[model samples]
Target: MKEIRLAARPVGWPTAETFEIAETPVPEPGPGQVLIRNVYMSVDPYMRGRMNDVKSYMPPFAVGEPLDGGAIGEVVTSHAENVPVGSYVVHSLGWREYSVADAARVRVVDPAAAPTLSAYLGLLGMTGLTAYVGLLDIAQFKEGDTVFVSGAAGAVGSVVGQIARLRGAKRVIGSAGSAEKTRHLIDDLGFDAAFNYKDAPVRDQLRAAAPDGVDVYFDNVGGDHLEAAISTLNKFGRIAMCGAIAQYNDVAPPAAPRNLASAIGKEINLRGFLVGNHSHRMPDFVAEVGGWLRSGRITARETIVDGLENAPEAFLGLLRGDNTGKMVVKLG
Candidate 1:
């Protein structure tokens, strides 16, 4: 078996030199454990924060330890009576070809629920859950609300836009880094309007897109985008601060949104959330989003990078805005 480990902590953006791949003997399953052959793994923006040796909601990846995220695998051997062999399970043990984990840590996923097992790592898994909770619960999205999302073409943002549209939001606007992504937002993802953030200032584009003002802001890219949303937010608006991918790899501290003061007078509610903190909502999320997915009201888009060796590159590509939706690394 092969596993990718962190070789060094990066100052800014990580490079090829930051990772080291090593081969090791596949371990046997112990009592109350399962041995898994990984099929797919997710490389998300949040993984960058885990690379640094700092305190966070989640622990940092150690220099010599194999990096792990979200992974789906087939159980090759199971000592636990509940987790039988050949069962497909989702676990937090990625960046490796195989994994040996206690059965308690793995959740059995139904591949039939979606198009593929990889869907569990993206749409039906953490990424999809993040969008569902952020929009519907945290933001208190209501019918006829005008919603704007930054990082609008990302895994979470793409789903957020579609859910907002399906839930009867009057208008859905998004901002992506490229014109092609912006086009994907409008033409494919059912976004009413989208703009290339690279082409012009976000405030001007958002102002033009939603002249009446936005009721909900799903923030994925936080710097100027947050400021832009704050400026255009209507009274009693809501902002779900899901992520700040814009400054994830920066060495310096990110600048606060310049126009955040507008949020006070506008009575805008801004809340930062972690999907792990809201596991209570998972059942409802799976039911609603699962129904939308099964009925074709929702779409699951992904950019798969073949092989475990390329997982680091795939993660870097995600940060660079090279992927359309969820970025997954195929191991099998």
Candidate 2:
């Protein structure tokens, strides 16, 4: 078995030198455990925070240990009663070709339920759940609301816009880094408007795209985007703070949203959320989002990098905004 481990904590952007690939004997599943051969592993913005040795909602990834996240695999060998051999499952042990985990920690996945096994790592899994909970639960999205999203071409943001539309948002606007992604939001994802933030100042772009003012903001990229959203939000607007990808790799303290005082005047609700905290809503989320997927009212897109050896490149690419939606490593 081969796994990638952190060789050093990155000060800014990580490079290949920060990662090490090592081969080791594969372990057998012990009692109440299962051995999994991972087929797809996800690389996300949040993983960058894990690389730093800091206290967070999730523990930091230790140096010289396998860096793990969402992974979809087949249970090649099982010692537990419920999780049978050959069944597909999703777990949190990724950044490796294979994994050994307690059966209690693995959830069996039905290939019949999703378009593909990798969907479990994206639209049908944590990625989708993040968007769903962020918009509806955290942001308290209401019908006819005008919504805005940052990083709107990425996995979670893409879904947030679509879901907002399905729920009858009056308008949905998005901000992306490139013209291509901005077009994707408008043409493919059905966002009412989208702009390339790099083309102009975020505040100007957002204000132009959302002339009526934004009722809700789903924030995936932070910094300027947050400040812009704060400036453009309507009175009593809500913000679902899902991630801060822009500042994740900063070597020094990143600039704060200078106009945060606007929140007080607007009486805006800005709440940061971790998807894990809203697990209680998973069943409802799945029922609603799953139907949308089946009816073709929503879509899941992924940018896949082949092979376990290229996982670090995929992670680095994700941080570079090189991918449109979910970024996954296809190991099978």
Candidate 3:
């Protein structure tokens, strides 16, 4: 078996040298444990924060320790009655070819229930759940509201836009890093309008796209996008501060969102959230989003790299805005 471990903590952008793949013997399952042969692993933007040796919502990834994220695998061996061998499960022991974990820690998933086995790591997993909770709860989205999402073509952002549309939003707008992503939002994802943030000032683009004013903002890319949304927000507008990918790798603090004071006058309700804190909503999330997905009312997209050795490049590509939706690594 092989596992990828953190070689060093990065100063700014992480390079290939940041990770190292090492071979190790596979371990046996304990009395209450199962052994999983990983088939897929996820690489998300949030994993970047884990690289730093600082305190935050989640613990930091230690040097010399194998990095872990969302992963789905087949149970090759099991000692617990609830988990059977040959069943598939999702857990947090990625960056490795196989994993041994307590039976209570893994959730069995039926591959027949989803379009692909990897869907459990994205659409039916935390990625989809984040979008569901952020829009419906944190942002307090309602009928006929104008909604805008930054990083609108990525995993969570893409789902947020579609849900707002399906739930009776008056309009759905999004901002992406490239022309192709913007086009994906407008033409394929049912977005009312989308703009490439690289083309012009976000405030100008947002003002033109949403002249009537935005009633809800699902912020995935903070800084300029947050500032623009603040300027265009109608009074009592709601904001779900989901992420700030725009400043994830920055060595210095972000300097924009200079118009935060405008949020107060506009009565903007900004709330930051972590999906882990809202596990109570999973049943609701899976039911609703799962219906939309099964009925073809929503789309789940992913970018899969072929091997575990390339997971580091996958993470670097994700941070550079190279992947359009959920970025995951496919393993054998």
In order, the Cα lDDT scores of the candidates are 0.93, 0.92, 0.93
**Span of ten consecutive residues with least summed lDDT in model 1:** 253-262
Q: Once model 2 is optimally superposed onto the true structure by TM-score, how far is the C-alpha of residue 88 displaced, in angstroms? A: 0.5
The reply for model 3, stretches above 4 Å from the true place, is none
Runs off by more than 4 Å, candidate 2: none
lDDT (10s digit) by residue, model 2, range 1-332: 89999999999999998899999889888999999999999998999999999999899999998899999999999999999899899999998988999999988889998998989999999999999999999999999999999998899999999999999999999988898998888889998999998898999989999889999999999899999999999999999999999999998877879999889889999999999989898899999999999999999788989999999999998998999988999995
Candidates in order: C-alpha RMSD to true structure: 0.9, 0.8, 0.9
Taking all chains together, each candidate's TM-score versus the true structure is 0.98, 0.99, 0.98
Off by over 4 Å in 1: none
